[model samples]
Target: MTINFDKMFTFSQPGRRVFGFGTISRVGKEARSLAGGPRAQVITDSKLMELGLVEPVIEALKAAGLETEVWAGVAGEPTQGLIEECRKDIENFAPDVFVGFGGGSSIDVAKIVAGLMTNPKDLHDYFMKDLGVGRFENPSKPLLAVPTTAGTGAENTWLAITSLDDVEGKVGFADPKIIPPRALVDPGLTMALPPGITASTGIDALTHILEPYLNANTNPFTEALALQAVRIVPVFLPRAFKDGKEKEARFQMMMQATLGGLTLNYGGVSEGHLIGQMVGGRYHIPHGVSQGIALPYCLRYSLDIFPEGLANLANWWGIDISGLDIKEAGLELIKASVDLLKELGMPWNLRQIEGVNRDDLPEMASAIATQPYFITTAASCCRKINTEKDYLWILERMYEGNFLD
Candidate 1:
């Protein structure tokens, strides 16, 4: 790959990160250091609570001599109303620090709650509107993110995604102030994940890695992290998927997710995420599963315009492109990605998803084209999206699981 030193880009991540098999043990100590007082709240979901994952975290906080409260209400993709209800529910606690524990949705709820705790406005006030980005006037309460899933990279990113029923889509609140200051990534937390969750979240991490690497906003810092993550996913994701107790695979996947989070923070996601967000909110599909279904089709769309980047991805996937042209190499990469999804037992097409009828493609395409987030990502896409027709073209291929010819 050729270097482009003149291209300007920026990078940032959480102030502190502790990653290992037993890093969850240190959360209390880390929390104490970042907390302003003795009160700490853990934001998670009912499922995690039922799994007894939140107890250790609570015990850790109490062991650190902090007064802890658990609000286990976050479920599925967080909605605007859910955020409001969570903020209202925890209003009396007035936590000095927050621990976001669980998957992306839970962590995102924590972020929004923390960000809105001190600020006077509602979460909607800070949502990305059209081309203009919203800014948070006040810094959020100190937050520590502990991710159980190896996808979404919500722990490190400055954005919080929420679904809005009014828009029938998802929107994000983007601000540097809301990014978690500390993270404890313990792969041990994921050892009990079911195969389906493992497969979907693993593919989600790969999508996060690839979009940033392939987009126009990529820089040296993001490229290094993204490519390393790319290599890790193809090897270890399957191991982790087949055997959730594979410690080594789990550890590597945790690292890959964290790295992918950083890339996602700086380089940003493009077409796949744009489409994923749309379909995910509309059909209530798991975020990672939606991203998996969109991955290869979106890459095929990008391949027509930016073969060089996709070719590099093909090389990293261990494809022998010695005798192939750029297009051929890109196609091989797409094939490899699709094959990986199949191997992991992911849905190969939009039609395979429940409630996603063939007739819904046009409406979905229109919604995607006009969505502010999609508009923002379109600028970074390899191929210029000229109209709803462009999105429709990709949607059509995705519906049929058609390979690029």
Candidate 2:
């Protein structure tokens, strides 16, 4: 097995993590500790509010004597326009501490609001070139993130993702200053997620773990988290999907998802996230769904370049391949990935996405080729993708459900 022992890798100093049932009640005191008598803005979506999740946190904050205001307008995927609206509300609230109190979308918006409130810059100022306008260097306010769903690992990451309509894709802003000061992960919060959402979000967590684990740049720190996360998901995701009421499954998935986020923040992701973003950007497909569709094929494509990594992954899946060659072990890993996807009810190809067609592949492939992460991350994969033509080849295979080919 080849290891990049001499390669340099950067690891983020993660914030404090408080995990367990009923931890949501700690939000009030936690917020206050981060900022005394904090006037907090709780960024979330209307659906969460309707689900009766928002009121309890609001009440808890009020009980702790903190002034709390709820911004429940965030809907669908985040965009520059959506974030600007959130920033306006944050400025009015003048919060000393911010709380991201829902899924990835809500957390992403709150991260942006927290950063922009202190720095006062346009969203575009911080975005990488392929996704947005420019860069902004500044610190954001302290934030406490409470994730309601087990996906996106938004609570653990410093990167904030948003859509650019002009480019019809997702872009991100990354800096250490934007990492949340505290993360409250309560598995109880995820018990109400619909089966479809539970499956999609769980798969998204798997993607975050698996992509970076197989990347050429992966180091020991990332490998530890990724190995644990990958091991847990195949077992727990199906259990959680089968019954959201299962407390044990919910709890494990929550922890694994956060670990996946940590892996992405530290080691970075590869072609799965790259192509997933392209599809999501173009079709307005939900992020997790796109990731679910892209991951298996992306893994298959990595077989030759990352045989050792894939063989190890096969073992993680509990696939015994003691006497098999590297290629055989890698193939078993791909099959295990497919079986897991089937158990989760995730669509494994572009054909499954309603209203999508092969004709859409070229445009999506072209757009991803322009994104720098796709180029950089894929450079480390088995099949390096350097041009739109290369991305198109991959996309065509994805569109046709050609995992074996």
Candidate 3:
């Protein structure tokens, strides 16, 4: 970890608090002021309700003297209309505080709903580059994020990964207002996650940290969180996956995920996130699973284009390519990632997963190039993306059974 001296960039402070295991007892007092004015709308999915976690969150709100309404409609690839419908579900409540209590998708829905409380626009208006219908002049409502899965750092972030209309691509809607006022991380909440979910989301956390750590935009503050996530995910993910009942392991993974989410606030992300978004929107692959599949290749290819500060990266992640060329160092990181993905039972390449056809490759490549955040943030030292052809070349490799020659 690099020594970063900027005090304003510090992650842990007094007002922004975190209570680990058994902290559910404090939800009432902690949430009181935020939930005071109107009914508190709790945004969560039916799976969580079935799993019995919603009962605890509801009990906490009622204990806090907050009127609560349950919005549980989120399902399968949350669409723009779904967000609008979710906005409608709570439109009647006019709730003062929104509590997101599921995986990343529900939490993202909660963020969009909070934005719509004051800003009267649909998801289409907030697209980043094109089709800009909404301008984010107004602030978002107060929000509280309590994540169910161990990944999607949505709880700690202000960016919402929303689906776009007509394009079949995903774009982020970002603003400081989108950031939740508070994050409630209870590792106990993640203890019940099934193995497949545990792997995909855990990989998402890994990408969140890795991309920021690699991107040139990273600062010392976010770097700390990202690096810590990198160090901890390897150790705790396996423990949490093998035994969901491992309270300590689950708690640690949750905290680490919070750290990963917070990282985006400071370090931001690069191509890995953008490519993952493309694969996810087009193929219906889980967000983290697809990102994990492409990361090593992105690292290997992008490194050739940017050499500045990479030796430092090689040393930071403790890869052995230090004595060799920069490309070798990049390969070292990818090799380590490949080993970890296989161990966690995630797909290493597109062919490893079923149902995705070869015919879709061109459209998928174009979709990735269409959204340029990854290209822009590849590395501070990295140049503009070579061409549309360059993107297709990489996507063609993805069509193969192997990312490596």
Candidate 4:
């Protein structure tokens, strides 16, 4: 197998340390102090509110002498107009700080709004072609990212992924100015998660690790995060799902999720993320399920062309992968990945996503061609594929249902 030296490695430095528990008491205190103001705005979903997830956070802020306005309009994947709406609402509260208090989508929206509210220009001004508009030349307001789910690492990273009405995959544009001034992770927040959601988000973090590790630009630093994430999920994910109150399982999952986000801060994302986003948006698949569905197939397809990289990944997972020949090890990784998905109850084929069919493969493949991560991560030397064929091939295997030898 050949590895490209020029495209070999990328370096990344994480922005902040993580503090975790099951409560929101400390978040408000830290956020108010950091914002240096009395007014704090929270962005979260209605479902979280109904679950009483944000109550402790609100009370904490109130006790800390911080007035708050909760924006409960965020749901589904984030969009541009939603950001504008959030910007308008904050004016009423005149909040000096923004708190992202939910899952990846909610936190991502809050992160962008905080930056845009403080920075100049229209939200789209900094899009792909806008030369210098979105650059984080100056810091924005004090923003605190508190995760309700162990996902997206929005707490620890600067990248905000939002969907466009006209676009297919989530368009990601990152600026250092957008990184939250502080990130507070409390695993207690995830204690109420249903088994299905626990399975999906855990797998999503797993995918983030797998993606960066598989990128042609795989770095020694990223490799560590990816391997640890891989190791943690298989061991702790089931426990977290089986009993959401298990502090040990929940704590490690949160840390693993944060690590995955930090590791991918600069290192590239793989075809799995790119293709998963495509599959999710077009078919209404959730992010975590999309990650679980696309990742193993992507790794399996890339194995033959990148055997040396695959070996490194196998070693990172601490499997006795060397016992088999390189080619055999590569195939074993695919089997192991599929096994992980089954453990999580993830769907393997497009058909598993209600309403998906053979006819939809062309559209889905076409959609993946337009994904955002493709620009930064696609390897010119990686295996060239008739993506439509791969799309159909995966579905075929998925339809087979049980494990493939």
Q: Which candidate number maximizes lDDT?
A: 1
TM-score of every prediction relative to native: 0.96, 0.94, 0.88, 0.89
Which 10-residue window in model 4 sums to the lowest lDDT?
129-138
lDDT of 4 by residue, 217-269 (tens): 56667667776776678889989988999999999998888877877774657
User: Which residues of candidate 3, in runs, are more than 4 Å off?
Assistant: 1-15, 126-135, 306-325, 371-383
Which pairs of residues have clashing backbones in candidate 3?
none
How many pairs collide in each candidate, listed in order? 0, 0, 0, 1
- How far does residue 78 in candidate 3 sit from its true spot (Å)? 2.8
**What number of backbone clashes does candidate 3 have, counting pairs of residues 3 or more apart or in separate chains?**
0
For candidate 3, the 10 contiguous residues with the lowest summed lDDT are 6-15
Look at candidate 2 and tell me the lDDT of residue 208.
87
lDDT of each: 0.85, 0.81, 0.71, 0.72
Best by TM-score: 1
392, model 4: CA deviation in Å? 6.8
Candidate 4 regions with alpha-carbon error over 4 angstroms: 1-14, 129-138, 166-169, 315-322, 370-373, 376-405
Q: Write the per-residue lDDT of candidate 2 for residues 282-345, one digit (tens) a residue.
A: 7788889989888878887788678888888788778899999988988888878878878878
Please give the RMSD of candidate 4 to the true structure: 3.2
